[model samples]
Target: MPELPEVETTLRGIKPHVAGQCLRGAVVRVQKLRWPVPPNLSELVAGQTVDDITRRGKYLLLHLTGQTLMLHLGMSGSLRIVPDEIPVGKHDHVDLLLDGKRLRLTDPRKFGAVLLLDHDPYASPLLAGLGVEPLSAELTGDGLRSRARGRFVAIKNFIMDQKVVVGVGNIYASEALFRSGINPLRACNSLDSKEWNRLVGDIRHVLTEAIAAGGTTLQDFTGSDGRPGYFRQELRVYGREGEPCSRCGAAIVQEKIGQRSSFFCPDCQK
Candidate 1:
């Protein structure tokens, strides 16, 4: 799935081209996705200018004249800007028509979403229920610690909870925890102020670097420009299960936490 960095990368990649551009219309090749593409999507978006583009968690928001378009690139989806004359691929499911170009959405797995919102997106149930953005000012050590109180969940699962913090997916969670020198299996409330602070900083650092590198492309992720993310090459312990830890020479280990594969340096990450 496209995590925060990948979603942010897509937002940045397509915003420049789509913002302020009038949408001629939308073409929904298939109406069924993770959620059904709005039936009247073409009519709703037609002739409306995209006033702005932003991201909340892994969802992309295209602020139109009076409505908002919310998109979720599910398991294996990508957006691309291409000329109108370009031939659409089999997986190209939707297209937002522009003057002479189009913003195309390709979802091989058909798990992406295109929803038309007539009201405020941030006020909607979808965006309203989301946790604080991990990159925002609200994400501090103290705030996290407060939410973590009384939680016996593993640290990895605690951070991965969408209600506690948004956009920290499995891969980045492992990377951040590894950088924080905290074992993923540790209970969430076991951390002190200093450890919480360190973990918060490392989380921000890992996400910032991943965004700069265009996100981790372990399988199907790519920016709107159709470029694969390069951060996978820089992964510390996410996938190198039995490999030597980069910092401590001890073998990096993998285990199932919250039913998700988690990798950590057993020696370096205490």
Candidate 2:
């Protein structure tokens, strides 16, 4: 699934072309996605100008004057800019035609979503319950330490919780824990103030770097321009299981935490 960094990268990549541009046309080649594409979505957005484009957690929000379009890239979905006349591919599910250009959504797995919100999208159930943005000033070490009190969940699982902090997906969670030298299996409540501080910094660092690199292109992920991310090359442990640790030369280990793969340097982390 496209995580926070990938979603943010997509928001940045397509924002310039789509922001302030009026939607001349809205086409839904297929109306069935994770949830049914809102019928009459085209009518709702066709004449509106894209006032802004922003990301919340893993979802992208396209803001118009009176409404918002919420999109989730799902497991194998991507948004790309293509010429308006370009022929649609098998997976091209939706297209927003603007100023002779097109912002297209392609989801081979059809698990993505396109929802129309008449009220504040931030207050919508899809987005309202989400936790703090990892990069936001509100996600300080003290904040994390407070939330972590009495929680016995693994640090990896705790951080991955969307209600605790949004957008720290499996890959970034592993990398962040590794960078902070915290064991993924460590109990959330076991962290001290210093450890929490280190974790906060590492989370910010890893996410910022990933966003700069356009996010990790593991499998079908790509930027809005259809380019693969370069951050995978900088990964220290996420998928380097059984390989030598980048820091200590000991074999990196992989385990299951909350049913997701958790990778770390057994020698360096913990």
Candidate 3:
């Protein structure tokens, strides 16, 4: 699945091309997705201009004339800007037509979503209960510590909770915990103020660096320009199970925490 960094990269990549453009309508090649593509999507967006674009968690919000279009690039989805004459590929599912150009959505698994919202997007159920953005000022060491108090869940699972903190995916959580020298299996309440401070800082650092690198491309993720992310090159220990730990030369360990694969250096992360 495309994580926060990948979504952020896609937002930055496509904003320039789609933002401020007049949306003539859409061409729905397929109406079936994670949620059915609104049957009247084209009519809902017809003649409207895209005022701006923004991201909340993993969803992209295109602010239009009287409504908002929310897009989610599910497990294996991507967007690309191409000319109207370009031939559609097998996975090309939807196209939002602009002036001589279109923004194409390609989802091989059909788990992505294209929804039209007539009211405030923030209040929608899809985004209403979402947690704070990890990159925002709202995320603080004290805030996280407060949330973790008296929680016996694994620390990794706690941070991965969408209601606690948004966009901290499996890969990022693993990498951030390893960098902070915190074991993923530790109970959430086991962390003190000092540990919370370190974890918060490292999470921000890891996510910011990943966004700068255009996101980590482990499989089907790519930027709006159809370019693969290069952050995988700088990974410390996300998928390198049994690999040597860069900090202490000990073997990196992989375990199932909350049923998700977690990678950490047993020696470095205590």
RMSD of each: 1.1, 1.2, 1.1
- Residue-level lDDT tens digits of model 2 in 1-270: 578888989999999999999998688889999999977778888899999998888899999878998999987899999998899899999998898899999999998999889888888888888999999998988898899998899999999999989998889999999999999999999999999999999999999999899988988888988899989999999889999998899999989988998899888888
The better-scoring model by lDDT among 1 and 2 is 1
lDDT of 3 at 97: 92
Runs in model 2 lying further than 4 Å from the true structure: none
User: How close to the true structure is residue 218 of candidate 3, measured as C-alpha lDDT?
Assistant: 88
| Candidate 3 residue-wise lDDT, 153-253, digit = tens | 99999999988999889999999999999999999999999999999999999999999999989887889998999999889998999899999999998
TM-score versus the correct structure, for each prediction: 0.97, 0.96, 0.97
| Local accuracy by lDDT, each model | 0.91, 0.90, 0.92
In model 3, which regions exceed 4 Å deviation?
none
Pitting candidate 2 against candidate 3, the one with the higher TM-score is: 3
Per-residue lDDT of 82 in model 1:
95
